[model samples]
Target: MTRSWRPWIAGATGLALVAGAGVIWSVRGSDPGSGCERTTITIAASLDHAPVLQTIADGWLRTDPRVDGRCPDIRIVAARSADVAANLGDARAAGGSAAPSISPTAPLSPSESAAAAASAVSDASRRPTVWAPDSRAWAGLAGTRPEAASLLAPGAPSVALTPIVMATTPDRAGALEGRITWPDVLRQIATGRAPLVLGTTDPTASTAALLTLMSLADTDGDGKPTAAEIAGPLALERTARVYAGSVDVLAAQMSPGDSAGSAPGARVSLFPATEQEVLRLSASGDAPPLVPLYPAEGVAPADHPYYVLNAGWVSARQRAVATAFLDVVLGTAGRTAYAAAGFRDRDGTLAGLTSASGALDAAYRGRPLPGTAALTEVLVRWRALRRPANVIAAVDTSGSMTEKVPGLPISKLAAFRQAGIQAVRLFNDRSRLGLWEFSSDLSGSRDYRVVVPVRTMADQVGPVSQRETIIAATNRLRPHSATGLYDTIDAAYRAVQGIWRADQQNILVVMTDGRNEDEDGFGLDELLGRLRAAKNPAKPVTVLAIAYGSGADVQALQRVTEVTGGRTFVSRDPADIGAVLLSAMVNR
Candidate 1:
């Protein structure tokens, strides 16, 4: 319920400067070293609190803030929470004790998002001494790895507060007043009743997205996710497009110029965002306003936790300065800065932006932060059970595929080969995959050859991952012999059944450029009977067939997939194969 968000202007001159200037430049104020040694201390503040943090730090530094009589250069950096997490997560996994070399901080990649702070901020090659993410959700996520529990100093107090809310167009907010929830929204998406495309940031990087990801995964309220819970999202939400670090830019992306599916000038989207985000962006008056929608089931609130790094790179002097910095945040100076920015104080006290919460501004109360042990428990469960997919694809390698797609530069097989490589990237490491290439007499009398054995993407095939193995095999494909479609699909169906796990989504997809060419091959009627007969009511194998180019039999492929409770897709133009393949991959 509480996660402070992107792009709400607070009262500080620094906040206004950043919001208007499209930058977060490092400031080395007039010589802090009148007669003392000079040192630079960088504070990696989450985008939600960067401006306020900078303002407060500047005020505290004016008092000649120092460590061991060393005058310090207070540098406040606006780092997206997700970018910092990946860097810190990597360091924790590597067990690196040394501090990262102090490289000059990089600006946000996109010129505009520097204000939105939409790009990843931390360079993967470096580390910082302090991290102030907008929520304990980050702390919980980072702490999932065992060493991270001890690697980051704990109990950093909250400096500001915000609640997560479902933001929608002003017109829709009334009808959905109290009935919406994460489960309800996700069910609509999976069931295809969802009215608009949902927007989200990468869960690993954004606290708001992490909270939403865990919520979307925990439909049964078990506090842990199952593959069944993950399957729908894995298939349906696949096209939602995970942005690098911007909830502020989500609705804007709804315009056709930014992403797919939406009609031109159709600027509208739905997402779980912070109250301050809805308020701040609405206050801007340039774009159409978004109304806040509270879920029937509660949301987790975000508290801006100020963290001082516990790695070897944090010297005692840096730690001392960090402690002093923490003191200012916990004191009146920080509270005043946050209040002016339309954020709640640590105690849930609000000021300056009541109307900024948009339509549902009445009596908004932030939920309490969970204790450390409970936070750790939830994150552990999440880490153990992120969504996993089980998909096996059968690619047609018949000689007819060698014919060039009409009006296209590549052959039917070449287009699909490239599509196969792109599709493999849609699945995470937890998912299992396998591949087969089919044509007549590929191996002895068999119509198909098992090119890459079905295995989890995490597995190493000699020196590369199973995913790489699948890609390499696809790259090496050459159309040969006649299409042996029917029998090969049946073989892959049986393969999925043999390895089917009750917890995972079990699917088998067949890609072909032409109809069965083998005279000895089983007829379509015979193949459909075998598939229907082999079907397990409990462990179903969904079969999807894609017909590439106009030469392939669409009706036959449809009949084939229909028997196994799946549908077929057509890419009559090889140019459309990528979109069609993606549609096939995530189609339920």
Candidate 2:
């Protein structure tokens, strides 16, 4: 484990992982070559700070820094902060597995022993010798995952900082600039009171998203979002179109000119992103400048912390190099590099251009992140809420779907099928779901055909499972017939009502691009009549209909949903289907 290395450079709210071996950097700088083995130290950084870290690494290389009598080879790569912590956890798990077996195990020969040693080194090589996540929150988050336990070394010093914020154009910022509470916006959208559309990256992978959810759901001052208040924000997932997976992409999509800050795939009015991103977007680029909508409470500043891993694989010399490199990062060189990259110094002061950066114009106030336990609670509650749905998804397979959407490259049917599969994937095994494809005479005299039967998602159907069958069926579906919207809704609604599990949330979802064209089947009036007549108070089936493309009859879809006390969402652009499908399928 004593691989020689060059001088080291540079890790979070703090998921306070169990204390590991502490690193103390007090060594003097040595010459370029130490006549020792050449070692490479990799720093896996969050997207925000990866570039800046590379700058620091480049400077360190010039100095030909040496630590513990070994020259260091520093490498920096962009990676999710949570992933690095998880990898460390996995590495420790691997280390445990690599340990020699006891009892009946036989001694390995020369060739066999060399092969085993090579496997061990290969695993160690893949893991970053140094982990530099964007925020302290990641450390706190890592504490929640059992496998990531003790993966981060103790005393990870905060080097640079940036707050999590809602980024929007200057004009829009005026309306949303205070202690911006997100739940209120979500509730307004859910109840049909507001026309505002906001976008966010996936919370599971993005720290900016996770911290925003933590803030949005934390209605009470308890520092954790309770189930009671979290429902409002939970709808953010359903209306299905609000998710924008990246800051750069969302910023580009949301221009000031697009009068309607509509579908996330198109443009959103507001988006949650890192402060540096907002600054970078506004400072330059064809995209409009963005301002911050600071939460009424406070912001979770991404505190770039430096962690010297205490894992068994990180030898004394590697730890020494990591520790020394951390010193370089906190010094004048590191601080200067980070500031040049639009990050704040360890102190509250900014590096000029504060107004454009979307901070409170030289007024930076950041609150301490919650404890690991509190952070873990928020995640657990989110996982508990964003799951287990009972749905009857009906997709329109009309010939009209064969035509490509105006603004998108893919055909309407391709986008529709993708959206359906994504919505079903969001559901868990505990839920019961069914998939149906509809067109003119899709099945002998019937306008709809059951691709998958309603049952527990995990249930097996002959050779195919419920989840697998729906995905496969939707992919195999083609478009060559006419729309039969009315009858399909009636049948799916009745199907949901028939099984009617009191324990689960039951709802029927309809995805269509056009109005009813089947003269042989029931009309819109008859369909609504059947739904109204068959509606039982005990077994309620809410209809969530998604009208894809411009051809959809909004009035007709609206009337159909109103009968079942459900809602209709219109996706004028086929590209918006995935973003719109989740919010449509998931019932509150």
Candidate 3:
């Protein structure tokens, strides 16, 4: 099938099945492979494979006699584990009337990862016959499957499981007397009593990383770390680092006996089971001495599960292979393999598992991590906490900005003036808006004067005055001097800094169509550094940037936003300026 049709089919099927009974089932007819004819089946494995899974794969192929001549050919497609959900989605869209399949070569993009899991149950063409994810938490994404309750016959085997553990340096573990609690760990990092270093796979992309964060949030009794919490004294005690991209990169950087001055160095520790496997390598002399820390507050294990796609496209032969494979993986041998990989074999012992394992088992099977929902709620709350923002609109009114479009008679300056007027009109009354146009020299010679300070102006009063002021400022802004975008933004930040309140959010909305050419008491880097360090220290301020036309250092604006958790929008169309500014204000 064509690539275009694939995603459409997957998305449609997953949505249909999930919205309906949650459990998707394809009618079974006479099995195509009933006579014991062999067929090839592809397995899409996630990137993070626990040791137990590898062991099971090795043992299963060797022991299964049917595989020698009679059974289906099992072709393994080693793709990034995160892509499995998306692949399953595509399979579902293709319709399960026939056995589901996927293009092994296809990989998900960054944005695609967000919808991958959901699309699996919702998409039609991308569904896979079977999906072995690193955590059962993913099952929730499939929606409620009541049919799953009745699908199991008298003696059905269970899915997969993997235990999560913390990996730390032996010296670090010794400081805590072998075991540690989450609170104590946080305290040590906060108090500088112990040099705390922890690593995890990327939370945005890795299921393991997400689960680990969820577990920590549960332990903290907060959904997730607040911006304030992340910026707290603890993070400053040492450099709180985020090893984005891959765990292997972090592992390689932190592996002992390697260079001590590398990015994270070998002293860094990792949390969760995947890292524990790395620790095992150290124990075996393949790496350095890495200790596993079982937090005293309790430990949580990852519940890895293998799910079957019940879309309409699943053919008789594929269904048979899927069933047979599930049986092989979840059966006695499968459970043993999981146990060998540090996971508790609780296939037939859920009640006993919880009763005996206590907190660890609770973490594995609990209904959403305790603080996850709350943490997410808090994060959202914090998003708008500093609701009414105080922004200074620093516009570059350089001579180049007056250059007419190659064919158009209207100069860029006229377009900017119109855009600035529209932007001022769109300003929220709750927001204290000001206008400052600068070129080689400050247009009005008022270096840092408030055009409109913080106050809820009536519909016609404040906004009208602000618009008039902006228009007058633009009219008087002669295109005689060079652009000092950096200097203007710096002065605006300082001006706004004087009126910034702890409870209110302060923002510097800078619109520049050119680079910093003139006025330079302080360089761009120094000015940005001052802004970064200029936060009230009690309340944080964010900087939003809008790049218009061309050659306007977009990267510089993005850097400012990244450090402040703000955002940057680029637009060549002058009309879009107002909407972009409004979006930044609302988002801030």
Candidate 4:
């Protein structure tokens, strides 16, 4: 994702409040009796809950007498939660001198209205007057601030608290005693003892999904589940049953007798929950009842909190309005709304709701919460467990790559040179990185040069310093060698096999801009056989192929990636080469 920031210039000479030597700039104004006038408040919310928040905003504006005559038009600007904080930062920065002050945003999207309120507290200059998130944890993350205050006390009044329940069919729950544990679930799926159905939203895009994974890691007695934990023998064997996407999408896939035309027995039976809220929303009077299973292990609550930024340009009247809105949201009425949404009351009590009986064992309540540090460690460890990757960065020193494109005087070869410099820098730091160049037979063949051997280095070095060395080497190549694409990949693979790391994740990232025509004995079939044989019983190596320019073979490169379990990207613009390579590395 590209990082974006908006720049705004502020107007000159606003009243400055210098209380206790702290600079506070306020734009003086009054609530002019312009009642019922349409105004817009831009809201950045998670996509999953944007629909619900929109519903509430429309309902509140139409039905509430207090808001009927006084409410301003609310305009929501929805985006991923991860993008909210950065976008808010841009908006705040843009309001400098030439623009009006506004509210601050959070790094993560809010899970509940209370969390949105808390995040608003940090927006001293650009305080959002209203906020509605999906969970209470957002409130905790948002905390209290000097310019903004918590609308709800910590655990005082909850907008909603839902239990993380397991969604399985009545039949599947029968053999498992209705109660389930992470180990039991994994065992059943691994051994093929039970037809298990597991679904999770993309953790990258959803905070609630990530929390569920964290809860599972905690239940496993493993603080964090590494990629290896997820891709291990057990997980790999269960891959046929795993689904990653939105909750609604998973629900549709699990609906019984609802499969359009797949196998007769294909049905999803397990799901994560937010307690009563999900159950009520998922209920259909005509469909099979969606049952809930509380895992024997303790559950983790989604604590969404609101945050606000305090700057020097907030107007006093706006501040008062924001404060009023905050108070109203944390009051009894807001907490009641929270409970109605299937959230636990602020006290962490389940209220009068009974446990799912046999669905969860009493002994499971004491399981410890998963730590963030532990999860990070697991990711790192899993990365280490992956077979070491083998990469050959094939460059084009052909006359075309050396020609300059319009606007930019820099030749395509120069761009490739710079990308090579970057690739080397990345390879030097991680895995086994190497370099190769191909052109016409006039320049003859160049063997792979070991730029950074994975086994030789202990502490990885950053690539900035090595730019001059790579540039100097690249500049020496004449644009006359044959573009022996197959030969080079064959050479690189052979080189990779010679220096094998049994447990490492073997990979090849090939960068080329032309077709393959060579004299080397390596054919497509032989190369593939070598690639497959390298992994044996375990799937190890991966090849990420990048084809630049119109002459590149997109299909052949895609086939290579498919066979190797890697990805392929075709870049029409050479400038994008560096970024594409970087993405492949991070993902690897």
TM-scores for all predictions = 0.54, 0.56, 0.47, 0.47
lDDT of 1 at 405: 71
TM-score of 2: 0.56
Better of 1 and 2 by TM-score: 2
The better candidate by lDDT, 2 or 3, is 2
| Candidate 2 backbone overlaps, count | 27
Model 1 residue 61 lDDT score: 67
Find the candidate with the highest TM-score and give its number.
Answer: 2
Candidate 2 — what's its lDDT?
A: 0.66
What do the candidate models score in CA lDDT, each in turn? 0.65, 0.66, 0.49, 0.46
Top-lDDT candidate index: 2
Residues 100-157 of candidate 4: C-alpha lDDT, one tens digit per residue: 1222222122342123222222323333333334443333233322122223233332
TM-score of 1: 0.54
lDDT for 229 in candidate 4 is 38
Q: Give the total clashing residue pairs for model 3.
A: 44
- From the highest TM-score down, the ranking of the candidates is 2, 1, 3, 4
